[model samples]
Target: MSHPVVILGTGLAGFTLAREFRKLDKETPLVLVSRDHGGFYSKPMLSNALAGNKTPASLVMKDSDKMSAELGAATIHKGRTVAGIDTAARVIELDGGERIAYRDLVFAVGADPIRLPIEGDAADTVLSVNDLDDYGRFSERLDGVTSVAVLGAGLIGCEFANDLLSRGISPTVIDLAPRVLPRLLPDAASERLRSKLAEAGASFRFNVSVSRVDRAGAGLKLTLSDGSVLDAGLVLSAVGLRPRTGLAAEAGVRVNRGIVTDRLLSASAPHTHALGDCAEVDGHTLPYVMPIMQQARALAATLAGNATPVVYPPMPVIVKTPACPTVVCPPALDASGAWTVELTDDGCDARFHSGDGQLLGFALLGAATKQRQALVSQVPGLLV
Candidate 1:
C-alpha cells in the first residue's frame, strides 16, 4: 500500500488542502491529526460572533468523522499530538510510541494568541479566543459579564470591542500604541473609526498597557501603566498571534517566525510541506484566509504531481468593525512609500505612494471603502 498523506492539523489549511487534493486524485489515502475535537469552523467568525448571535456549538460546520468522509481522509485522529518527526525515515511518531509513515506530510498547526505578562493573580483568567474550543471557554466565562476590558487596539481587538458593544456590553479597549490599528490604518482613518466606536459605547486608552488584573468584588480591576484603573466583568487579551513552530523546530525543520516553506509550500525536509498560520511561505507569514486559500490550492496541485508555485495577489483585509467599516492593503515592509491622506467627517481615504508616485497601498474607511476593488487593481501583487 502507498504511504498516506499525513496532515498535522484539521484547521482551514489542512482540510482545504485535503479536499482540493481529493478533487484531483481521489484515491490518495489521507490522514488528518488534530489536538482538539477536529471540527470544521471558521476561526474568523469568532471575532464578530456576538453580533451574529453565534454560539460556539453553532460555529462548528462539521465534526471530525463527517470531515473525514467528505474530504476522503481515511481517518481524522482527534485529540492526538505528533511527538516527533524522523526526516530520514520519512515518518512521524505520535505520543505513546505510535508511528506512521507518510508519502507526504503537511503542517497546518495554526497560531497561538500572545498573552502579556501582567501582575496580579487574576491575570491567568484573561481570555484570548483563538479556536472554537477557546471561544467556547470564553463564552462560558462570560456568564454574568456586563463589561469587557479588551487589551490591544489592532484589528481583532477593535472588532471584538464593536461586537461587545452591539451585544449590549460596554467595552474598554486598552492599547500600547498611540492610535488604533497603528500598523494598518493612518492616523486620520484610525481616529475616524475610534470616534465611531467610542460613540457606540466603546472606550479607548491609547499608549497604555494593562499592568495588572486583580479581583475586585464581583468584577475585575485592571490597573493601567499610567496609574489609571478600570473595572470590568471580563478581561480579553488580543495583543497578537505567534505561529506554532516549536514542534517543527524540534523535529529539525527550519523555522523562523513560522515553519519556513518555499513557493511550492515545501518545507526544509523532503516530502514535508506547510501551510496556513504555521507556515512562513517564502518569508510571508500571512495569517489571513486569502493567503491560505492560495497556498492550499497550490499545494494540492503540487501533491497531485503538478508542482504549482503559490502566487499572492493584492489582498486587502476588510476590518470587521461595523462601527466604522474599513479596508486596508498595507505596503510591503521593505517598500519605501509615503501616505497621502484625504480625511473627512464621515470617511477617510489614505493612499501609500512610492517616490515614483505609484500607489503601493491604501486604507479606506466608511463609504470610502466602496472603492476597494478599483484601488486594489492598481497595486501590484505581493508575490507572483
Candidate 2:
C-alpha cells in the first residue's frame, strides 16, 4: 500500500493547497489533520464580525466532513493534535503515540498570538482572538461587557475597536508607539485614521503600555507605565502574532522566525513542505491572505509533479475599519524612501518614494482609496 500524502492543518492554507493540488492530480491519496473542530471560515472576518451582526456559528462556511468531500480527501482527522514528525521515517506521531506514514508532509500549522509577561494577578484573564475558538469565547465574554480596553493600535486592534463601537461598546486603544499603525502607515496617514476613529467613539492612548492587570469587581483594572489606572469591562490583547516554529524545530526542520523554506516551499528534507503563516519563504513571512494564496498555488504545483517557485506581486492590504477606510502597501524593509503625504478633508494620500523618484509604496485613506489600482501598478513586485 502507498503512503498517503498528509497535511497538518485545515485552515485556509491547508484546504487551499488540497483544492489546488486536486485540480492537477487526483489519484494521490490525501489526508488532513486539524487540532480544532476542522471547519472552513474566513479568519479575516473575525475583526469585523460584530459590525455584520454575525454569530460564531454563522461564521463557519463548511464543516470538516463537507470540506473533506469537496476536496476529495480520504481522511479528515478533526480534533487530532499532531505531536511530532519523524522526517526520517516519514511519519507523523499523534498525541497518544499513534503514528501514520506519509508520502509527503505539508505543514500549514499557522501562527500563535504573542503573549506578554505582565506582572499582575489577572494577566491570564486578558483575551486575544486568534482563531475561531478564541472568537467564540470572546463573543461569549461580550454578552455582558459594556466597554473594552484594546492593547495595541495596529491593524487587528484598530479593526476590533471599530467593530466594538459599531455594537455601541466604546473602546479605549493603547499602544506603545506614538501613532497608530506605526509599522504600516506614515504619521500623517495614521493621524487621519486616528481622527476618524476617535470621532466614532474610539479613545487613543499612545506611548503607553499595560504594566499589570488586576480583577476589579466584574471588570479588569489595568495599570499603565505612567502610573495611571484604567478600568474596562473586558481587556483585549492584540499585540501581534508569532509564527509557529516549535513543531518543525523539534523535528529538526530548519526554523527561524518561521519554518524556513526555499522558493519551492520545500523544507531542508525531501518530501517535506511548509506554507501559510508558518513558512518563511526565502526570508519573507507574510501572514496575509494574498501571500497565502500565492504560496498555495505554487506549492500545489510542486506537489502535483510540477516544480514552481512562488512569486509575490504588489499586494496591498485593505484595513477593515469602516470608521477610517484605509488601504496600504508597505515598502521593502531595506528600501531607502521618505513618505510624501497630503491630507484633505475627504482623505489622506501618502506615498513612499525612493531617492531617485520611484514609487515604492502608498497609503490611501477614505476617498483616496479609489486610486488603489493605479498606484499599485507603479509599485514593483516584491519577488520576481
Q: Which candidate gets the maximum lDDT versus the true structure?
A: 2
lDDT value, residue 355 of candidate 2: 95
Question: Per-prediction TM-score, please?
Answer: 0.98, 0.98
C-alpha RMSD (angstroms) for model 2: 1.0
lDDT of 2: 0.92
Candidate 1 lowest-lDDT run of ten: 68-77
In candidate 2, stretches whose alpha carbon ends up further than 4 angstroms from where it belongs are none
> Which digits, one per residue and each the tens of the lDDT, describe model 2 over residues 1-384?
678889998888998999898898788888899988888898889999998888888999999888888877558888999888989999999889889999999999999999877778889889999889899889889987888999999999999999999899989999999999999999999999999999999999999999999999888899999999999989999999999889999999999999999989999877999999999999999889999999999999999889999999999999999998999999988889899999889989999999999999999999999999999999998988
Give the whole-model CA lDDT for all candidates, comma-separated: 0.91, 0.92
RMSD of 1: 1.1
- Summing lDDT over every window of 10 consecutive residues in candidate 2, give the lowest-scoring window: 67-76
